[model samples]
Target: MLMETPRLVGAFACLEYSFPFVTMARRWFVTATGIQVRRFVPNDEQGVSALILPIQREEFGIPITAEDQPDLKAIPTFYQIGTGDFWVAVQGDHVVGSIALKDIGSGQAALRKMFVAAPFRGKEFSIAARLLDRLIEESTRKGVTEVFLGTTDKFLAAHRFYEKHGFQEIAKEDLPASFPLIAVDSKFYVLGLNPE
Candidate 1:
């Protein structure tokens, strides 16, 4: 079903514990259509993993060292356990990508860990732009006045994506220490969803 608040559009279905079944339905829709999109759910565990792992390896190029694999494992778990607002894209039963928005503070949030799998790369920008449009609108409804993100240097594509969607680089000196993982070789950007 679809629900709308002034800030965002939300869609959901209760699949009665049939994740694989729902995945199949999503894939079929993708194969038949040119693109597929949906809100992210905690139940999309496997699809979430599929969407994330390749991005982690490719963007960070962290070798399978003693600490790497477990770190990679920790990410999706963090996403599942930490936040409730996520979005997913699917094509013909395969999950192609995902993005997450997490509340950071009063009237603020963070966009985190966005990725698009190889097969869905070309449409990444448009898909993400549309999703963010919805998410930002929804955030306004939920009382978020701004949203921020920390993105790695390697994600040149993502940096461009953020710019096109109206995010601006935040001066490093002005950033708060409380921004999670913000100091870790990533640039920060902010979008004023409710500009004064």
Candidate 2:
């Protein structure tokens, strides 16, 4: 279910899956904060890269380039298959944030490419939350029972945000085999969509 209100709309949605054992639907939403989150389109790749690569390389001081990640060029094929999709946050004509879910078979997904610009990082913008809200909202609709993610240990704030949003810290060995592993990933998390 998706809930929206007016232009610069308020949004909420809940998605449900059966394979994880006919679980209850979980609802999440984003308040209208003047940031528009939408599905990835052909034209958005450059903007998406412009938003993410710098965050990975400069903000986080990670040693990588756009070529290091093929998904940056093959968004449609890599992230937009089955229940998976990528989303971007637009402020004016520029892309400021991103989040993506990759259907990794079974009832699981790998959350990837979540990044937000420095200016948009906190409660004032909630850009990260908006991108995540969009991803989770779609995950339930596609019947994904659990969402997993990998992050670097350097992202202390990101760790807190993920924990605050219900993702429990998990060991690398505990992640699903299909969950895409990143060389830089030193931390992992999982959010169960169904009740235990």
Candidate 3:
């Protein structure tokens, strides 16, 4: 017998996801509501842009545009090269979030393009966490030893989020030479799969 118990709390969506035989990993799965997390498909480019651009430009006050970021125009060639890939979270036809891993060679990769809409940015949704977890898991499986990322100090919430998920703060000098350092990203972080 299967049971479907639904409860509402204030303005938040369903807070409990009952799993009869699921492990902790599955616990982080984007099972909240009808949102589905998956790899980036060709059609997702437009949606990805729409979802990420506003977050970076309007919300974060970054002066970047789609033109400055050529990688967005060529995610397959830029991000899907070697062990790198991009992912998006969607509900119906709308993209709610996006994340990507760029293989920078030397057994290291760079985490990029992590953006979740304001409506979906909280523990209630776990969109950011799921995206980060997915990137880390996939990169590790592809033999990526360490994941490097850069961010501006403006993203205090993002810094906390990354740190909470095992990413350690590192000086810019510690980053690999091949790492694609973003101009706006002043602070840097790294997470090693095989920590020494």
Best by TM-score: 3
Candidate 1 lDDT tens digits, 70-137:
42234444433333266677654555667777766666777775776543456533666666766677
Q: Tell me the tens digit of each residue's lDDT in model 3 across 86-171.
A: 99988766677899999999999999999986667788889898888888778878888999999999999999998988999999
Q: Runs in model 2 with CA error above 4 Å?
A: 1-33
Model 2: colliding residue pairs: 15-140, 15-141, 16-140
Query: TM-scores across all candidates?
Result: 0.68, 0.81, 0.82
Predicted structure 2, TM vs. truth: 0.81
In candidate 1 the C-alpha lDDT for residue 63 amounts to 38
TM-score attained by model 1: 0.68
User: What shift in Å separates residue 42 of candidate 2 from its native position after superposition?
Assistant: 1.1
| Clash statistics: count for each candidate | 8, 3, 0
Candidates by lDDT, descending order: 3, 2, 1
Q: How much is the lDDT of residue 4 in candidate 1? A: 10
Residue-level lDDT for 169 in candidate 2: 93
lDDT for model 3: 0.79
On TM-score, the stronger of 1 and 3 is 3
